[model samples]
Target: MPRAVTLIRSTALSDVAEYAYAATAPADARLIFLAGACPLNEDGSTAAVGDYAGQAAKAVENMRTALGAAGAGLDDVISTRVLVASARQEDLVTAWKVVRNAFGDHDVPSTLLGVTVLGYADQLVEIEGVAAVLDS
Candidate 1:
């Protein structure tokens, strides 16, 4: 099936960023707005306490599960916002690297943020995403 999401790259924009600068989907495509995927285990405990990259990976896994339930995949994602609990740029970069690797060549438009805290205890990362998919 043809993908509904299209990642946009701008030559005018510096190529330093790991992800695309923008993305768009056709009007008829079904849009899936996912809640922030947290680094929580199935038992309600935090998956990776005090570990930025680990938490980010867990969040990405949860995000994938949510997207699958909504009939979409990572490739269908048009944009993402990654929230990391830290004042350090290195911490945010660690989380961003995990997410960027997960998306591979898809490289959806993304925003990485550093926040003071997250909802769950020991939760260091959360990922919110928007995906577009066409119904058969």
Candidate 2:
């Protein structure tokens, strides 16, 4: 099996991301798109209300569960879209910190969006991801 890893960078953007990703990955690779995951606990209740950090953590955990169902993990994620209800810079930074800690050294391509509200009344954050299953 052969694998390739590419890190896109540009002076215009501090974060690493390609202007455009490869239209098609290698043959035999399986692609997976997880649904938007919210900060809901296993009991079907919001994990944290008005707490970006806690919501971010729970959202990531939900994302992991969705990825696992598709035979993928956090490391396999190629891209992510994070949604936060608050547009405040401090709130955004705090949520991003949680995501960064979860990803650690792997800086997966991501887009963070700040919105005025979400589907749930108490939900503060949501996360979704795309992953590729490598051929063994």
**TM-score for each predicted model, relative to the true structure:** 0.98, 0.83
RMSD of each: 0.6, 3.2
Give the lDDT of residue 46 in candidate 1: 96
**Residue-by-residue lDDT tens digits, candidate 2, 23-120:** 23455678888888899988888988879999999999988888888777777777778888887978877887898789776577778889899887
lDDT of 1 by residue, 23-51 (tens): 99999999999999999888889997999
Error of 2 at 114 (Å): 0.6
Best by TM-score: 1
Point out the worst 10-residue segment of candidate 1 by lDDT: 40-49
- Among these predicted structures, which one has the highest lDDT? 1
- lDDT score for residue 75 of model 2: 73
